[model samples]
Each structure stands twice: as structure tokens, then as C-alpha cells.
Target: MADPQDRRPAGAAEVLERLGRLSLRELSMESLLQTVADLATTVLPGDLEASVSLLVRGSPTTVASTGQLAVDLDERQYERGHGPCLHAARTGELTMIADARTDDRWPDYTPRAAERGALSSLSVPLDIDVDEQVSGALNIYA
Candidate 1:
């Protein structure tokens, strides 16, 4: 049986169109994050799940997630205090784990991620002004 979330990869044009609509919506930060997560799962290839992790008052919080899997994965990293998403949020750098099972950097996280059926992950830091203390990471799991 096929996963219901599986679908054909979206074209660049379609992705752009969906993003453009985001600008027109009167969405709050939470709403915007949800929209972004939904769009990511739809536009990206592979059996992907998406989530947004935000650092508020120096604590990691999952502001939005496409599904429970995303929330669970984020919690795994938060509990261990290390993972691709946490690294990206702190350093403002893109962190890609091509194969979670083989990734030696986050020994504790890799195994848990693998158990969740996440073979790979990509975490991108959301750009924020230097004056703003807020930090965020956009996490994709496959």
C-alpha cells in the first residue's frame, strides 16, 4: 500500500504560485509557519514531513508542524540537546543529514530519527535581523 501523503513532485512554477499566495494572506506568525510547513511537504520530493522550530526566550519550541511525526522528531532533538535542526537554529547555517542512520554527528538523534522512518533531513535557519534575538529553523524530514 502507498502512503497517502505521497504524491508527484511539484514543479517550480507551482511552488512559486503557492508561495506568492502566502504574501496575500493576512497570516500571523504561527499561521505563516503552518502554511510554510504544508507547502514544504507538498513541494518537496520524497516522503517528506516539515516543521518550524523557534527559539523563544532561549528555549526551543515547535511553533508549527505538518504532522505528529514532525513534532515527535523535533522533540527527540530537543530532549537530546543536539540535532541538525538545533544546529541550524543556533549557527544560522544549513544542516543536511543525508542518511540519519549513518550520521555520526548526532549519535543519539540519528538512531531515533531512523526509528521514525526518517532516512534524511535538511534543516535551514530562518534569517532574522541581527537586532532580533529570535531564532528559528525550518526542518524537513524524509
Candidate 2:
């Protein structure tokens, strides 16, 4: 069988166009998050894994993920209460780890992520209005 990653869209434009066609307002939050995760994996470089982490009932949860690896990585961060995705969701800032194994910031998270085959990661905050009780981060792992 062919590698599934090889079938993803080759360019950001294609991903963007696909996303733009979605009726976001009509979709449930779960569906929207799944679409975002799918687009992230398709648009981003490398053999990427993608997930969306969101605060549900004041607890962080992986709302949607491209693969089990993404969900597992997010769970690790949630358990530790720190990681690129959690930091981004809480601070509304972008966090990029060029190499998780060598990143000293999250001594707990990096090694686990590296062990899971995630060499690098990027986490970007999702802009939800203040009235919305949801804080989210788009996490891409490679």
C-alpha cells in the first residue's frame, strides 16, 4: 500500500481552497475541528501529524487529530500541564520546537515526544471570541 502522507495536497493553496469551501457555520464544533486538523496535515510540510486541542468544561482535550500519535502527544502535554500546544492555547502565541529531543524548555515533554517519533512541532493559538468559553491550539507534529 502507498503511504497515506504521499496523497495529501502538495500546496497551501489547495488546502486553503478546500477549507474555504466548507460551511463552517453550519458544522458542529467537532466537525470543524476535525477539518482543521485534516487541513493542517495536508498543508504543512514533512510527514506531519496534526491535532486540535481545546478546552472543554475547563479541561484540555484533543478535540480532533489526524492520527493516534497526535492524540497521545497532546495527552502527554495535558498530563504535564505544559507543552507547545498548551502554551500556545493559554498565551495566544505561536510556539515552534525545531527539534523536540534537544528542546530544554519542556524537559518532560520533549523526550516523550521524541520517543513517539515527533522530531519537531508547531503550535498556533486559535482566535476564539471572548464570549466563547473555548481556547484552542492547532498542533502540528513531525
lDDT of 1 by residue, 24-127 (tens): 35888898888777777777777778899997656899999877888999999999888898899988999999998899999988998999899999999986
Clashing pairs in 1: none
Give the Cα lDDT of each candidate. Answer: 0.84, 0.85
User: What does candidate 2's lDDT look like per residue over 19-117, in tens digits?
Assistant: 889996799988988988887776655687889999754589998988889899999999998999999988889999999879999999999999989
Clash pairs for candidate 2: none
TM-score of 1: 0.90
Candidate 2 accuracy as lDDT: 0.85
CA displacement after TM-score superposition, residue 102 of candidate 1 (Å): 0.8
Which candidate comes out best when scored by lDDT? 2
* Model 1 Cα shift for residue 7 (angstroms): 4.4
**Candidate 2 to native Cα RMSD, angstroms:** 2.4
